[model samples]
Target: MSLGSHSVMQGDNTLRAWRTGIDTYQEFVVYMRRDCPACRSEGFTTQARVLLSAAGQRSIVATLSVVEAEWLSSGDAGLSESAWAALGAQPGEPITVSHAPPLYSLSHVRAKVYGHKLGDTEFAEVISDVAAGRYSDLHLATFVTACAGDRLDLAETVSLTKAMIAAGDRIDWGRQPVVDKHCVGGLPGNRTTLLVVPIVAACGLTIPKTSSRAITSPAGTADTMEVLAPVDLDIASMRRAVERTGACIVWGGSVRLSPADDVLIRVERPLDLDSEGQLVASVLSKKAAAGSTHVLIDLPVGRTAKVRSEAAATSLGRRLQEVGAAIGLHVSLRLTDGEQPVGRGIGPALEARDVLAVLQGAANAPDDLRQRALCLAGDILEMGGVVPAGSGLTLANQVLADGRAWARFQDICAAQGGMREIPVAPHRQAVDAHASGRIVSVDNRVLARAAKLAGAPTAPAAGIDVHARLGEYVEKGQALFTLHSQAPGELAYAMSYVASRPPIFQISPTGESQ
Candidate 1:
């Protein structure tokens, strides 16, 4: 069989490459655009060809997502994957890709990315693709990874932030200086939004704080908050609550704050890959579009948490602060302890109970959660430039102790539909330690996976509720952790998973006991 160049008809661009192999693994070629130099940088890039009847051209274009190969780690692979998906071409189906305009080429930035701002039309095309569900998760991953690491210069971050904002619905509060806060979350139970919003509103700030349901963890702020109140409110309902009470903590997933973000997150969550640049963009884009004037970023640094060291935290902190300034907002990043989960509770319903207890001033309210919330609220007050530095913490504590935050919380909850208690799953089993000693470490990722095994987030009530934390001493027979599930089978599955992956936690001093 002869392998050689074949000129194929396409609209504006020519696709040419050596026909190298065929049969079994599929016929293959090394393709390149003589006019576009991007292919040269990453060997040969792949582009799937799709044939469309003249009238069918509109259908194909409408169904396709924008593909920019130059910035991807495997731009060639990404382009091949997305284009193949777009063509809806089967294994044996022939495809001819028409030469159409490239949505927004990264070729210009390939020189060194000195400065590049997307024009409106180009911006619209990418958003259209995202909204249309045209791109696969991996393709989205490529977009995120290419932008990973390093802070985009002020001008670039600002432009990208604005473009992301324009990509989705804009909430006009008909007011100035909307208040919001976000944690660069890794701590398991740092459910501060459950407390901060009420305090800020009580202090006369319009905080329509939208949170998320658990993506990977046992719970999210929305999940915990949902235990005491409704979190999945419609956009109109959410806006009305904020308009009426000056604060609302509803889930953004329901209202679509930045829809493109939700799609990207679905891809990133499983891959466990949140590239640095994408993270900054994802966090700030939502805040900017929410019309927030001042935002607080919680950076929890710990040995096992998201940012493992103080140095890492500070580097991220500087980027967030500087970028916020460029985008015309005041951003304050706070460093918090993330050595372990924030509160005594580890799952959704349990965390909700903790939130309510704090609000109602229960004598045994989770102190750790309370302190975290106060620190965040205080910084928020300082950012508003209303509570002077050094005075904000004192004021935040006062709001908590005086019962004003509690009352405001109740009012906001009632406004966000109505308050109720969600029941924890009744089926449960406990895991006791095999030996006695101080709890040396708790592997968060493993623990999170175990919770998933037990049926968390989906099961809602079913999750591991840790009775012991790091440094706590326990008897050999004492309960190390408890697994709750909707069914006995699921509970057993969790137990089996735990047994197979031993030492989710380590006990000190070495000795087998009762």
Candidate 2:
């Protein structure tokens, strides 16, 4: 494996393409027997980087996995789902395996690992390779780690953001003031985007809002919105929905906007590393590529939230504004309370119910959720000049109160495809308090962990519903929260974690836990 060559010595073995039911999160993987002719001829072993070519028209770099099972024979090679889709190979098609070409852009990553700043051209080349799926997960991890913890300066951050935007498809609305909003998420049950999009759109703004699925939380905006209508709209469908209803709520991954961000996100989620520079780049790149002229960023601050303090929030906000301005976007930052989950529900369908309650103006809707959505929507309204500086809240409230936002939401859902009823979990259990006292604190991170353990986002209907609020009085054996799951094993797993940990809800007679 030379580092300076692009030529690959093709192997003599031609194997059948067996589809392995494996999910590698967009990374290509190929499985072959330990004693396969290709492995012996090409000097390939487990974990080797190999180039897979089919029909001389498609080629991809994949990691090698050795299989000892009967599912794959010596003359057969198995492709993971991602690889199979990338190659578009039939089950019995012949494929060639060879040594992968040298990834020259990785040298820049090595320089970054050694504390050297990368130039704009270096970042462009690196991001191009990343977006093209030329890097393995290990390479992605190394690159992400190298850029972690304030390693990238302001200039470098701008370069990276620009590089990321250039690496993906950009949508041009050919219109002014294309508005969008994003929340720096950490707290669970914060599904405000679902409400804010409808409100802003109802005010006659072009708001094609694209959201991501959950990475670490119980639910993401896309995951929750998917419960009511489809969120995986392609660019054309998304445009059509926006044209029909003045707005849309769809998944960002479907549009190829800032594709490098998604590629990096796949690696960042498992590592749990979100550096400041990368965060700014990730947010602004998508906004820029989405044709947004004005953007609102929500920063929720708490001890357990992503932005933990006022100082950190200010710094992040400044960076976001600076990068966004450099990329031709007007960025407005808002710092809000992240003391607890935004609503009573902490999963996909459960959060969708909360959103619907707010939109429909139900008396039982969570006041916190409704008020937060109103505030964000108000700010967005002002940003788009749809309302006066201080009067956006009044207008937003009027729209929601007068049933206009609800009507707009339904129209947008229909335009996106169709609306569906929210689902409910099949199995449920309530966790009760052991001692009676006024509740003082709730750990957002722990509660979110329990919800994920209960199979949220993935299970669609699985999550937790809160019954106790901060400073609320409770009796011994009173219900504090209910866990929803699709399977008994998942419910048991969440319950076991809750049983072993400190009470997620802290209560004291004096209310001093805060």
Candidate 3:
């Protein structure tokens, strides 16, 4: 079949495809010279939607950018890394460039902006367009903003979740009671997934765990898992790893599951807009798409955490359960203390170190992290019917205590790839308490920001090592936390930010250093 028969071929306007070597993540971009013949004739402006078709009948609608540089000849149209891969075009191959057809789904987005409720069909159209890369960044941002806060009702939230699930690949494990776990993130150093997966898998449950990289925090499960082993596993590798070890901890994005949720997240991250409706949809869509029949949700509630008050936690938890029920998932919620970071570390390599310590049952391991992981793992085990309701904790603890969880972790890592050596940052600086007192509070947001400034998930080895916890007494000049960074400048940046702000660790005057 000819490409012209299915797609709109606007005249014979075409240009030679040239690699521009630009990386824009998932957004496809096409570059054309300012004086290019096709640009002048088609009246295509920068950021204009244009369809690029290659010889093999492949096509993609990309946002156009007019290049002022003379690097491209008049006849050549440059392609960004995303566009180049999408079209599968060779060097100097002719690519047909034309104005993209108008998007009809955008009307639904506009309706949402004016406080209108969107139905299943409406959301489906909008998400389908979004997944197909038809909507540009502006359109995506608009869609996200319109649905922000309480703008989306329960029905709309359910519809949106269904739409997101439909837009991406879904896994079917060909069995009953496939289990998984997720955290409603805001707390830092809470890497329970790494511990939970192995415990559950060691107990003989099928857990194909897919995690996301850090969206708003210093390290996500995937980032920390990457520090210990290869986490960017595709679907086939993930399946193989699970088959071998009864579990797999891999990045969800690589498997192309809930793709539209990823796209929405890119916009939501920069905006720092995690609406309840969208948050529910984002977490549950990924869970549902992973073919999970039973799921455990960890909600860490604190004044400085994502879910602050008890009321907020209750509402969000109910919404999660309601949404999961509507989508055929049996959801279990575990609310925990978010008063402080989970463990002693706050970055990829640092958190991985903590995870290793807990799994290996080291005496000095962070007791808080270990307990939280066991609790969440226990919940998953019970939810999967592996253990009777109250007995899950004992079973989970026994697995960890006997070194079974640690051994299974090694097996899973080996299955994914070989276990990797945890990285160390060459530069480090400590932030100290100026006065002696008992630690009263620790701000999660400040610590997270300081970790990011220290070059976190990006640098892998960079992060903070927390020294003080709530109710602990410290002497003047005692270290509160130490910053780790690969570069001196990053170390300095994190230190400066910590200094400029109120003490991250609040200490009430207790007269003497204990």
Candidate 4:
């Protein structure tokens, strides 16, 4: 039987065949045709289809899934499973086979260190297949690999973003310059979004920040905000929340924003590959769909962060700027230091505590947290033209200190659901400074890991709240940090992990410090 240009001629007629094991199936499986001599030659394979068991029970097959000829007209590799069954085969069977059956379309090129760019049509088809769920994990891998290693151009980035937006729910706020800000994440304790949203909203701008739950980290913006208020608002309810308060912090995962990107993210997370093209599309499409006209993107660049080198950071920054403009979004990128996390809290509840402190004007609100929030808010302010040029920082600070930001935050949370105090972990574990000096560097990744081991987003209260910061002097016996946990065992486990590790805190020998 010819599948296409070449005949599916039998390669071998001998008894010799490669044996393969069948999984979870009680009876053996193999392919056969009712009309073939080979089918007649093997009595069991000849029947139209029949069940054979050790008990000698037999059942006749009336019909199969019946995939028609259109599916199998081309290469058998692309053949539908129903077509395979129609030709008579069980998937796990050890069947007699021939040479490669007229399939000449595939190329087996060895992949290089970095991937090459895919054509626009090819890329769109790949995304189409991904969106339609026609591609399996392996096919998705090929799609991702083909476009990996910064392989997309500015137009491609814009196209991909538009495709992603088209694939998901789009929010039309019917307002010009609807503003949003996104952090290309990596710095742990960078819970600035919680502070940024309220401040931007306080300055009479519409800011709807839809955040993600943690994938590999201890906490995400959604996770930290979850510590303060409910974040799982649906599309209609969420829009109402934003309308009532002029701002909303909702969970993006729940509302299906850029849904295909969510699927890609799941695979990307495990592979540890953040493809620049995919990253750009994922960010901007969500912003575009959310109806953002102005976007301030915070790209933290350092050795340990997402965009490590300045060269990579600069390239990414330019790409973001260009792509945003192409998509009709006014864009600005600020590269902050990823050498250290921006806040003293390293988990959801702990970070929520830090944010609340900043909002409520607590005496112990972290200066780094406050400063970054104000700076990012200032950028949004200037970019959205909420404040005059050169005075973004001053305007932001005034709104924050004079109780306007806090008041707005209260209103927004109440509009969503009432504001609640960040919950405290009933169990507390304190770690004293091992060697006191001027605090230097803190490894946020390790610290975040330790917090996860304790209990995080789930435990709400379970996390690390740093009592010390860079350049801060501490006594050897003074408490360096506090670990909060809802359970005693979790507190113990978290404490044990912290104890086994060397000083997460880097301190200088020189006593004189700020």
Q: What TM-scores do the predictions have?
A: 0.75, 0.96, 0.95, 0.75
lDDT of 4 by residue, 246-328 (tens): 89998997786777787677677767876787788889888887888899899888666788888988888888888788778
Measured with C-alpha atoms, the lDDT of residue 180 in candidate 3 is 91
Query: Could you tell which candidate, 2 or 4, scores higher by TM-score?
Result: 2
lDDT of each: 0.67, 0.91, 0.91, 0.70
Clashes of each: 6, 0, 0, 0
Q: In terms of TM-score, which candidate is stronger, 3 or 4?
A: 3
Put down candidate 2 lDDT per residue, 226-314, tens digits, no spaces.
Answer: 99999999999999998999899999989999999999999998999869999999999999999899999999999888889999999
Any runs in candidate 1 off by more than 4 Å, and if so which?
A: 1-128, 149-156, 510-514
Q: What would the per-residue lDDT of candidate 3 be over residues 1-514, giving only the tens digit for each residue?
A: 1111122223447787878889987789998877777788899899899999988789999999887865666677788898898889998788888999999999999999999899999999999999888989889999999999899999999999999999999999999889998889889999999999999999899999999999678998999999989988889999999889999999988998989998899888888876999999999999999999998899899989999978898999999999999999999998999989989999999999999999999999999999999999989889989889999999999999999999999999999999999999999999999778888888999999999999998999999999988898899999999999999999999989988999898888963323
The deviation in Å at residue 471 for candidate 1 is 2.6
- Descending-TM-score candidate ranking: 2, 3, 1, 4
**lDDT of candidate 1 at residue 121, scale 0 to 100:** 49
Runs off by more than 4 Å, candidate 4: 1-116, 153-155, 510-514
Please report, as a residue range, the 10-residue window in candidate 2 with the lowest summed lDDT.
Answer: 1-10
Better by lDDT, candidate 4 or 1: 4
Q: After superposition, how far is residue 395 of candidate 4 from its true place, in Å?
A: 1.5
